[model samples]
Target: MKKNGNREEFNREKLLKGIVRSAEKRPVSMDAITNLVDRVENKLRSLGENEVSSQQIGEYVMEDLVNLDEIAYIRFASVYRQFKDMSVFYKELKEIMEKDKKKNQDQDHSGDK
Candidate 1:
């Protein structure tokens, strides 16, 4: 359900449109986006719930986008999250940077083995 408590059927195209908008001019391919959407849709179906909040859906997309493309992730997040100001954007970018740093460190450590 949406924030307004109204219920509607899920539209795959609608979801695709949102993701496509974020992926514009990015390296992410249509196949990847379609697969991501498939995964999200499959996940929601697996929930076995009659209804799920729109917020939850958005969160799921954000999770997937972050792994797909950073630029696309930020683009989608700015809209899905409705970023208020530069501070919010800064915080999110910082988190991504921190995680990336940690990931690189882990890879470096693993290579030492």
Candidate 2:
């Protein structure tokens, strides 16, 4: 895996540890995490490349977490993004809230049809 222009061996255990840590105190299940890891591996394999970037893997993890559990997503994002201040955290929360609100609105509109 290439992280910040440095090539290194892909470490699945390290990836799992980060995921597990983020899910601590959250309701995300171990099975869910396993499935997510499997999916990420499949994606990487499908790309037909031996080298992948940490950012790419991080994006995949974030995508999975966002769909699986909001709290877990935030937890993972905080560490992945290295949030520096409350403002950054607040902004991330706001983006999630807005997206949720929009989704709810779309559902409401659909129900009216």
Candidate 3:
């Protein structure tokens, strides 16, 4: 477990760095993202919730090929939460949209006055 944890942490870091590199038009490598995701999933299972770090998740999502601007964290949560069906996925998605809507509304109101 410790070995896997170390590997996962490393992969997570690499993925984040890879994203930054790729955003700069540098080469993006799949090996890095695959290793990162594999390690993260394993860690999430083996380590459980409290053990899984936000940095790790952020790094995994920031992978070079991930296209961060085109993807939302909710998308990751869908797969990570392992939704049993479309309904469950949509429910989670609705919540996210609502939150974003509220945030935008607040910003608009604030800007008006």
Q: What TM-score, to 2 decimals, does candidate 3 have?
A: 0.43
lDDT of 3 by residue, 1-113 (tens): 13244423334555445444433443434565466466656756775554555555654554422343223344445444567999997886687678668878999899787
Off by over 4 Å in 1: none
Runs with alpha carbons beyond 4 Å of true place in candidate 2: 2-4
- Backbone clash pairs for candidate 2 read none
Per residue, candidate 1 scores C-alpha lDDT tens digits across 1-113 of 98789997888899999999999999999999999999899989999999988888988888998999999999999998888999999999999999999999999899797
Worst 10 residues of 3 by lDDT: 63-72
| Candidate 2 per-residue C-alpha lDDT over 1-113 given as tens digits, one digit per residue, 9 for 90 to 100 | 55569888878889999999988888888999989999988888899987888989999999888888888899999989989999999999999999899989999899797
Q: Estimate each model's TM-score.
A: 0.95, 0.88, 0.43
Model 3, residue 73: distance off in Å is 1.9
| lDDT of model 1, residue 33 | 98
Candidate rank order under TM-score? 1, 2, 3
Write down the lDDT that model 1 would get: 0.93
User: Clashes per prediction?
Assistant: 0, 0, 0
